[model samples]
Target chain A: MTMVAQTGANTGVQGNKTPDPAKRAASWRAVRRAAITIGLALATYELIARTGSFPRALLPTLPMIVRTLFAMLLDGSMLMHSLYTLYRVLFGFFLAMVVGIPLGILMARFRRVEQFFLPLVSALMPIPSFALVPLFMLWFGIGNLTTIIIVFYAATFPMIFNTWSGVRSVNPLWLRAAGAMGADEHKLFWKVIIPGASPFIITGMRQSFLRAWIAVVGAEMIAASNWGLGWVIFDAKEFLNADIMLASLAVIGFIGFAFERLVFGSLERNTVMRWGMMRSAKS
Target chain B: MPLIEVKDVSLAYDTPAGRVQGVLGATFNMEESEFLCLVGPSGCGKSTLLNIIAGFLTPTGGEILIGGKKVSGHGMDRGVVFQDFAQLFPWRTALGNVAFGLEMKGIGKEEREEIALQQLKLVKLEKFANSYPHHLSGGMQQRVAIARALAYNPAVLLMDEPFAALDAMTRDDMQRLLADVWKTTGKTIIYVTHNVAEAVYLADRVIVMTPHPGTVKAEIPITLPRPRDPLSVEFLDHQKQLLNYLGQGTSKAA
Candidate 1:
């Protein structure tokens, strides 16, 4: 009986698309459900915190963590830590771009460059950024330099690989067309090759930033920088200041999310997405 | 003297199987304001010949003379319209794509843009001047490509089956537009195509060639009036004549 009913419903939907209003309503409901689900989880966590399954000191409640975060912000310590993390990440990321972009372009454009760099990049790429934290700390000392170097090392490979493939995979027909249209080598590179490879380069930057963000936090934990969200969390572990650790973790996550959504989002808005090499997500 | 002269041009490629010729001992000439089409089956090396004329390829044999000057490499004088409509950089607006050639020549941006807009008008795409290539339809993209190829105002235009990718309706539209562009510009053109109807419609003269070591088989001139009807008796007669030549070329080759 249920099978027959299901078959009848399937037949009803087979020939007709779900109407636009229904689809929009369904999506709106989904958003509402997601918000409700998150609220419920937080409520449950708060309930558990009050019940005290574990010590209040080790497992601080959400409110305590929020208060800690607010107090730290008021004192400007949180801001300073965030700034330190941001500075290190940006500097190292810039270094990666400086080395990776030109190297990638050369590798793609010239056979000799590819022959030299490919093996080197392949060998260096597989070693995780955390694996290099000790080595980098040894070389650069335990501070911003070590953290920044780790970020650079983590970020550079993706940038290079993406740019290399992007340039190489550009439409050959466009090259010939541009060449036949009387474009010189310099003109061709700027006009055709660069724009052609930009979408991939942008993607490379996004991925590189993501990896660098992860690497910076881990490097800070190991290298124990005087200031940074990562260092705060690590420092909090000693005092059993779970509230401070949670607060710092929140800040780190927020920064990563903000950079991914806002910074790279606008970069994409201005470049490849605007150019139609990439499609916009929302209808 | 002819505006462009081809003297026994040939290209050979070396493979594991040894030497293979792309085009062999092909000699032709184009007078100023002439509309010539290279028509044959696939692999006839018509495109190769067009590329050589465009100076994208240097022929292993013979010389291509433009205004009695030996062709060395690609130059602005030869504007090529590829079969795939490889105009309009994806990153640029329609106007920007057209302006690319002028910009390369070191023309000021404002001046080049004005000229680009003019060429866009020539292709009836001035309204879409700011639109990227992806936003435009395939037909529109080809029109923009034509506009770009002409914006630089090349002395000779080399087209390699520019309409082959379009739908039948769009193809006809393109052919009419191309004919108008040709009559207006009076620039020498060397077009390559496999379609007999296309060559018959747009060209002043058609050169048919055979495949497998490509060479011209026949040169047939169509003296039909402007806006030639595809269904007309005279048009069908020319098509028949070209078909016969194509069949004969195949049989003789076999």
Candidate 2:
């Protein structure tokens, strides 16, 4: 088993021992850029607050939006809406993973199967989830199903494409080596193929999750039966409540950012970074 | 009885240019624990021969026998260390790469780790047990590759230009390391290389091959003592003779 560490160890002279200045600079630059961006945003908000031409109701100040957001939080509406959006996004994301990964692997491994599904995938891939809202409403009669379906539609493509590409891109040598070691087809798929393809699959999953979140919000705005962040923004639009709408927008952005950083970021760090497939520029 | 036998083996590939003969009616045998070197020019079917013995490629004609049984598909009985590093699984640690064979053998994790560590120590790479393949140099990678093969405890070791990519100093060190490992382990090895010096230094018998429908040109017995010096007159003479044989074969082909 060439998989063992003994043969893979470095017994000979070492090379490439330079200190990584790029990594240090990258983190410093990130912090500096973040500070500058925040400062500029605050400055813009202050400038808008000082202006008198725009109606205060239509263009509420950042402070006003924050105050409204705080009020909503205190009333439990913000928490409820946030939880509703999270549920839809998570449910859709998991559902997409369940359907997409195996399909992708099948497409990658079997050319005939890919050929059979090519037209269907190509047709469905480009059609926006929002574009399907009318058809979905006609079919499923408008509710959680419609929203979940939209999210599922938005998330499925990236997962399928990425997983397929990952499986296809596995080195032939690894397969040969595994075969030589007496790995059966099943073991080869589990041990060599899946692990080798995981980084790409995970990357695809992350992208799908982000897209699914966006699609869920769009779906909610168009077809929500009750409360969600998207519904809050849509409801505020009717009352001309710019503060509530802006606060909902900010919440959406924050949720997306947090999911990317906290979930996918840690996943990449622990797996690909530890495997040495990817290096974190930050460190 | 011979430990391994290749009887009238021939190989061909379906190329765009039609059937390209790789090895033509090649035959050889190896006694148990014998170190045999297969030396030839580029595209002389040296690698094809090794692959056939390793059961990676099926011969178009003839058969290979391992311990009197006909060779079938690839098995752990013959471990091949390919040229060009032959792709180390990037996700695995150095120890994990070496422990792969043990894992396949259904050895428990603790026992596999113990054997892998011992093998790493044998190759003087115990310090880099946690390191990945990309972090290691070409020579180090090949050393790990060699160690990976050895860890399988295969009946025969097939090496195809295993140290061809190393610098002169590293190559010499590897040659010495291989010799030490071979003497200690007493495993049968069939090494393939174009390097005459390496063939003379490492092999008990050097099998000279010619390209263009490859066939065995000569089987010169190496009568040198253990830890043979490359600078010695006897070694140089053998080296010269093998080089002359190769040169003559090439010219005749032309």
Candidate 3:
């Protein structure tokens, strides 16, 4: 997921450098290839559905899936489910950032802080978020709490690790230069350290958000939160409503793609790219 | 009283081999607005001595004084330029970087930018005010650094081989620019370099240092006029004299 977002960003940067006609033709080729691939996949699915080799309920046609998606949208259940999922993921992501960024900076700057947190973070980071879902479900009950906690757990490690590395890797020469220019500790951190470390911090945010997106859905499925898109998919499995399942999956994929492309993409453009911290990534 | 004084300053640290002295009893004094250069071979502790004066490192013995006050740590009165091109903040445009020292002094945005622009003009980098550090060439970036160091009006400027990374042509241009800045600002500068010709070309007085527990070896004064040519007879004589001091230092180390 991180690699996908990075490559997407890389191409966007490269698009500026390519000649106009060549760039236009390349994009048009990409659009045509995408259309053909989607069209072929839908046709194959529809053909298999008509064969009736599997039950009609288990393998719905494209029209049936589209109709179910539209009905759910018109009645607002799909919107509510999406909103619920977004809330959980966003809230958990926010919590991870608030805690992880400061902690990481502290760990990097102070020896004692690094000593205290390094061991604990290392021990906890390798434990997958899903492994803790059952334990959280027992502790917090099968609802928003368990799901949000899982997302937070999934997101926090990357945030902490990336921020830590970013802060640590800031060139020492800048620090000395800033100090010699009469920057106190507070000024140094705000002006020199934070801006210098911004590239890694931004990358950490992207990675953690992707982690939270994955964790929220999986947690919703297991914790049986009735309102989320993940719960809808899991609920449809019992009733053999594969059309609803496919519709929910499509919505999930679309939202994740939108956030990755629009939200973080603009963020990179504004901060790191504008500042020239990401020149190496363009090639 | 001298404008700046280094009194028997020394730095020693224990390594796996044993105690290694960085600078041993290095003592010197500079008059106000004087252009001083420390010239030596590698590991001569010229840089270490400059770092001590910049307040980045505390000497284990002796002390430094600026304007009759004991130096403790980094202060706004002194500005330092490092050799590394990465010394400039990558996030800031040339203007913002030049304005950083003023910002640290709590100067207002409008005024600081105004002063920073004037300093950039002094370095002839007014046209690149909007360009980021990475976009600038090595020599241009060093010029921005010089602008930044001068913006806040530091009493003394410390330069650690600021043009060491540039090509010969760029280095020559930078040397001329630096000499112009020194004359215009009238700020005392202590420049560190291993290049004998560079030291002779720029300094009013060149302090030659010896390596292997470094100490001051010779202090040769160059009274050549401004815009001195490097190939001129007197300039070559000064270079040859400074090189002799450097050669003696290395031979003693061996």
Candidate 4:
């Protein structure tokens, strides 16, 4: 009877099994949500257009924004500005990573270093990057340097904070296991600490990239010697070219979304998900 | 010389309230190739003692010697199987995880892979050589962890309730598999568990410890034959005796 009951239970579990149905349902839900949201947004726009409360000069139609975006693309100004902005963000992002990861590791491993940096990090973290734009412009004279400095300023804190937390949050058991296995300091850091902290570091990098991108736009608007997306928007604002301004804004949002989806999404999928650090929320 | 020796060892950790003693003046010795089980109530510092032997912690007092040399910290000579599911590195395959210790020791890749395969075969996990830890079940993961530790061919293998996480049938299977491996390798093992039947079934000598400033309370030799039946009268008697000892310890604490 016991053996039969066990067999019955096992068969029940086997029969009930379905592979990743939750993931399939989640994806379907997302598609449905997107369709509804986009449909409602278009209907609202049409309603506002018919009412004529929305001025063509101040808030151009979606079609006008698209047309303006296409024109800018054809003229090559959008590409040039995009490339400039990309250069500043990437350079500043890499700079923050190089400094932040090592500094975070130092802070995590050593008590004295953590104590010394705690005050400084706490003081600097709350100050927004926009506040540093004027100082950077004064120091570097309103060029790419000022914009890059602003991006760096915006990117550094999140990276530092996330990296430090990642390092600190590593399972103590892993460290103990490593130590029990005769892992040296170098091996411990590389094999255990770094791999353990990778998810948080990647998360930090993603956040820092977003912040730096915003800072670049803000800095470019304030210090407009360089041709960038922010500069295009600023120029359009002065000329009262609503289409161009809306087009630039659309391009910014699209690029930001694309970066998040294409770059960081793949990184998370390939590293954390593959390593079992995270379960797929889609499921 | 004894394979491993603990002389009046005591350990304490500093809590927010104050220093709390974990283990107190525990002494024991194990010969080479002996299977020793350390059994005690929960929070009696069985895990703490295991950690001290594994060189992951230092005792606040007393001394430990492995092959006549004082243990200072962790070394490759002592391999440990942690109680919790300490899966192999997620990034590495089963073969890679088992071969990691060898890789750290600078063994050639080909030789390490061959040895890793052999170890996996010993644990009946050869088919999972390329699988990641997450891809395997809890029992399979623990098997892989065991294979990884055994692949190094360490002088002593320390396990802290290695089978505590598995289902009953899986646990029984693991216990038998472990016995088979021990028979083949004859590696000195110090296993920690709270189960009396398991302790009697596996260990050459079962060392029981008391709680509240934990210390060794009794060491009983298992004279029962190998591949002993769980329902045997002798096994039941030993289990009853161990239970009595445990009950007395608890009552005293209360």
Give the winner by lDDT.
Answer: 3
Q: How accurate is candidate 3 locally (lDDT)?
A: 0.90
- Candidate 2 vs candidate 4: which has greater lDDT? 2
Question: What DockQ values do the models have?
Answer: 0.66, 0.61, 0.77, 0.55
Structural similarity to truth (TM-score) of each candidate: 0.92, 0.92, 0.93, 0.90
lDDT of 1 by residue, A1-283 (tens): 1322322222222122347887657556756876899899889988888897889998889989999999999999999999999999999999999999989999999999999999999999999999988988788889999999999999999999989989998889888888877788888898899899997887788888888999999999989567988888898888899999988988998898787756776676677766777654332
Model 2 lDDT per residue over B73-185, tens place = 89989887877764677788889989988888889999999999888888989999989897888888888888888887999999999998889899999999999999989
lDDT of each: 0.86, 0.85, 0.90, 0.84
From the highest DockQ down, the ranking of the candidates is: 3, 1, 2, 4
Q: CAPRI verdict on model 1?
A: medium
Ranking by lDDT: 3, 1, 2, 4
In order, what are the TM-scores of chain A for the candidates? 0.86, 0.88, 0.89, 0.88
Put down candidate 4 lDDT per residue, B1-254, tens digits, no spaces. 78899999999889998988899999999999999999988988998999888887889999999999999888889988877775467767889888878877878999999999999999999999998778888888888888888888889999999999899999999999999999999999999998888998999999999888788998899889999799998988888888787874323432
- Two-chain complex of model 3, DockQ on C-alpha atoms against the true structure: 0.77
Compare the candidates by DockQ and give the number of the best one.
3
For candidate 1, lDDT tens digit of each residue in B161-210? 88899999999998999999888888788889888888889889999887
Whole-structure CA lDDT of model 1: 0.86
- Across A22-41, the per-residue lDDT of candidate 4 in tens digits comes to 65565567668768998899
Count backbone overlaps in model 1: 0
Error of 1 at A93 (Å): 0.5
lDDT of 2 by residue, A1-283 (tens): 1211221121111111235776456556766877899999988986877696788999888789899999988999999999988998899899999999989989988999899876788888989888998888888876788888889999998889889889998888888877777778887888888888987787788778878988999998878866898888998888999999999998999999788766876676667666766554322
- Once superposed on the true structure, which residue ranges of model 3 sit more than 4 Å away at CA? A1-51, A280-283, B248-254
Worst 10 residues of 3 chain B by lDDT: B245-254
